[model samples]
Target chain A: MKAGHRHPADDDQDATTQLAGIATLARQLATAPPSVPDIASRARAWRRRQARKLAPAVVAAAAAAAVAVSAGVIPGSGGDSPAAVTAAPAPAPPMQTVRFLSSMASVAAAQSAPRPDVFWYERVADETGPATESWESTTQTGLLRAADPQQTSAIAPTAAVTYFAYEPLTFAQMRALPLDPAVLAARMRATLRASGRATGEHRTGSDQEMFESVRYMLGWGQATPELRAALYRMLATLPGVRVLGQGTDPHGRRGSVIVVALPLGGVRAMLVDPADGRLLAAGASPDDASPDDASPDDAASQAPAPAATPGGPGPWTPPADWTYRGPIHYNVIFEASGYVNAVGRRPE
Target chain B: MRTAEGFEPWYAAEFPRLVASLRIATGDAGLAEEAAAEACARAYAKWGRVRRMESPSGWVYVVALNEVRSALRRRRLERNHAGRLRAGHAPPPADPDDALWRAVRALPERMRLAVALRYVADLPEAEIATAMGVARGTVAATLHSARRQLARELAVLTIKETP
Candidate 1:
């Protein structure tokens, strides 16, 4: 993201020659049609036909990735494993080998053993800072409620927990997803714009000022539910990656969320409250911890909980040309745009 | 504030040219087109924020050109590090029609954008700097660096052809 190195002064002559060589090669390959109407039509067709075919596979692959996350994507609810945080716990019922297909089945079952309080019903609770207002219960209706409906396990409480495999409705999850890239871009743009200019002197304000970033980012919650549903569907189609058994983080939070493996891993992880559905704050996974450790916030002692978590906060825009693999929610897309260019090799 | 009425004509006129230059610079037509569109989209979305800047087109060029450089860099990285597990194959060797474009791709990401703007897209160094959100001296230095890189690449190719 930052510039590396460049030489000036006497280096000018050499720079020009280099620029010319590269530009010359580029000029020769410019065979695109000179017409605007044609290009637009082609782009439109690609989005409709090619994009449509590509979208579902991406969802499929991502769904597979999601399954991977059951051990890796979201942290294991039972946070004592030594492996990657994103790895999901195997769904081996108490003494039974009941293979789990989703974290909902596993986590739901784990939580099924009833607690005496209401906090257990609410997986995340907001204490303070950033996304506080957004804290609400998943048991309530609408996308605002739970992180994943498909992955949710059915809990039968009789002063004790009972987690029976109740795989959430995938179709219902898909139906409530977002798909249009352009619309997503627009909403993000608007939210970002509002954040920059929303202030009076642009310097500072009350507790409201602290929430500026949240206002711009999470404002999408206010958009039409239809769009939210579309996003839900899109996210569901992303790879299924759940963290394996959870463990204590370097910062020492009694437990840690898992990390998506390399190749498909996203940058940070969200830490939701086990008490309320609200997100507390978000910081980098332990792997992302910086070298300096000088910044108190960057270090574990005072790091804010990540307000955004997978299937909870906004989705990460997939890198271009990379096909969306698992559920859109998994963020495990791959860059398979242009590997092979023409004919192939002959047999030896 | 600038309506399509005010900008469309200029855009339609320059759009094809921009695409051609970006395609070469990025070594991928898709990347070029997307970069150009994303830059313009941002421009169109934030016309008010940029109208008063030194040169509006320059600003757009900076964004689009940078996009080209970034796209090229990303493509190269994916090709090199991703391995055969899932990546597509490397692109075919370049034809002359796209030689300069490939060369553009070969440039370091930032330098490539600066060169594309100063040479291929054909804008002044100052405006290029503004569009790129860098100091004027930075733009000048970047242009110089790109030219040097271009010459070396050309020289290498020329030497190989000698009898």
Candidate 2:
């Protein structure tokens, strides 16, 4: 008899009894499920990501239409038959990066902001030794337990307020950042320009600087969820940003990676957890050489090859050897972060 | 033609069962929850189309399974790299004392998946086939083989305990 088909009545009954015991054991393993609000937030993030992924195709079609109209070859635009008019090639859209950031924004927006009196505590680890823990309060008071034995612990007076790239911001300034992406981007640009003039630095308000500023803010700055979301949205709009697909941090945590092409050379890669919008790791590689030319000594060059774009014609593979080769200069992973009531207290 | 209003209850009812089934299938609590939540999120994102399907739960099961598979693939690659760098930092093995769980986990991946979808998710053979991307007969055969193997394992355990 067929496996699922009924055989003798006794044999069917015996199988049913065995299956029941297995089902009971399986059901015993069930734990409490995640809350609905959490899943709903993820759904919103997924929707935003889907929208961003479609943006490139939409832009390409619009560009094609504009070219057709200008050429006077569009059939409906009172022009000749559309024959051999070629549309200018559209720049590859950073679909995965945009989607990942958009998802991060959604996840960030769903989180509760830190309380007024609470300190933002974080544990960070580098490629070297043990993890170090730090706690920074809004009042610019904090404590740091460094991994180095010589200076193991210290009272940090100005931990909370730091530069968002070249533009310095106090905790208050970070909290008061505009929630709208365009408005925030403009404000960041203005601040960057002003700071550049004050410091006599010629290169300010560049996309690379802006990208670094956003990365710093998202990584260490104590911005509100609204501001964090806004920063992510702003980052999505920046040029020269590309998704290098998924990768694992030093601590073996999985995350999606986004790389920003530096103005001078090479790329800055950041790994972020899409589930919670947390910055897992950030590093930079100084070589623009393709993977084929990558030296075997390059240890941190474990980035996955370009992934196929979802629902697109073909994979949006980065220029050959877009994967960074050579050791990452500033590789660091955030082990944990949370809010605590006091400077010395760690999150439970 | 179900509206977004209809998704709330459906999600609430199905999410736990999906997680439980996935937990059994993958033998990793964290992965199961993450995959199930992601699948439900995807379903909610495209509810207009998913709600109209013949089996929304089946679709969710398929998506969750795919997520688990992708994550496992990534983990394998990461393990290879981690092995070269560090000596021993692998994830903890699943529980060894639970004979039933051990038997289930010992089954082939496809058989384990079939059993989980059938027994834990309480899905019919047809839906299990759809979710697993196998024909119905294959699912039936896999489940039958799994049940027979599980029965023998449990019987030996029982005999050992009888002393």
Candidate 3:
């Protein structure tokens, strides 16, 4: 080793001896090395699994890069370096984006959803906050249920209504939606168009509406495996869908993330387990605005009210008015999800 | 044809040494295995290109180290260090009382990776530089720093033992 400190070259001898000692100790640490055949098999399995998950996006990206080079949008080096060849290209076209999502949908559809005799329970272990235990009744009700009565009181306009009367799609309602991607996308567009916020005050456009709608549906936690796959396919068909490549969920399950660009420079990412149809986690962050432009502290102050003018509707607004307005920068780790015999019981 | 036939022999010769180096780097056998397995899998995926590289082992080492570091960072974020160390998967080394190994473990991740790769894997300075994604000069300096720290630690132990 080079003598990094200002010292005589003779001191290298003593350092070498000490390094030898460290080497001896490190050798003892490996008493039983993993077998080559074992590792080779495991490695092959991992590669196949990752290829199964990411092949669609990988192909689409390569194809897009090729097109970009041919069209003179990006200069091609034609070098032998794999890095040069596989460097992520610019965002793919809408059709390619839809195809990538369809691939994910196909993977999801192959997995089976859990069927519980009692309730749909989820255990969430927040990285930085208190752990939460939530269970939703399998049977859908006309009125939404609140975990905390005090929270309901806070949202209600008056004391006369003790519980919040908000409404979300029932499990039956979600299951009734068309499984076809194009049909689902059209239905979502119409839902956004007819909503009061779409044309009335907020003027939230179809893109932001679709983003919120997907998050809303998935967060319900009662949708069937097929419905969840349809949701992924629908989001894939939306504009500005970008694959964020392979990522690990908060629980350390490896998966790929796809993000949707939202209005007012926001982006929502969904971490889907490609092995199964499980939605591992979901998160959102505001647009990549500089701190000077749109700091988290200045969000509400900077956001103009969504009031309408006489001439036309106001500019498009963020999805802040939704019932589940996720934190500006938060990751919800889905630790456990399955049907259980009782609310407090975990699946066997 | 010979190169393709020789691949299994090459893998067998390299796997243990690589795992040992990573085990020292990560101080977790399970993590070492996981990272090494993933790297090997990736290498297998692109063997057409990887085998032609000047140092295929260096490529595998770089990928495996990255996986381990990311896993460590994520674990640190999710739980306390004590909680992680208590995990049943990473057993205490055989020489649990060895101060030299303790000092080695205490070294920063990069320095540990450099030391382990050089000493255990017996990688040349150029290969170590490639594996660590650093200049050969940087690898030399890191190893130097690690040795100086270990020397100081051993000297203290000697003085204490003499009394």
Kindly state the number of residue pairs that clash in model 2. Answer: 2
In model 1, how large is the Cα lDDT of residue A81?
46
The full ranking of all candidates by TM-score, starting with the best, is 2, 3, 1
> Compared with the true structure, what per-residue lDDT tens digits does model 2 show for residues B100-119?
77777766667778888987
Off by over 4 Å in 2: A1-15, A57-348, B1-3, B74-98
> By the lDDT metric, which is better: model 1 or model 3?
3
Q: What is the TM-score of chain A alone in each candidate?
A: 0.21, 0.57, 0.53
User: TM-scores, in order shown?
Assistant: 0.35, 0.45, 0.45
Candidate 3 chain B lDDT trough over 10 residues, lowest sum: B73-82
Alpha-carbon runs more than 4 Å astray in model 1:
A1-348, B42-54, B65-104
User: lDDT score, residue B121, model 3?
Assistant: 81
Q: Cα deviation in Å at residue B153, candidate 3?
A: 2.2
Q: Each prediction's Cα lDDT score?
A: 0.37, 0.62, 0.55
Provide chain B's TM-score, model 1: 0.63
Q: Write the per-residue lDDT of candidate 3 for residues B19-103, one digit (tens) a residue.
A: 7788777666666766766677667656778888888888888777766644443331232322443465555455457776777
**Which residue pairs show backbone clashes in model 2?**
A290-A321, A291-A321
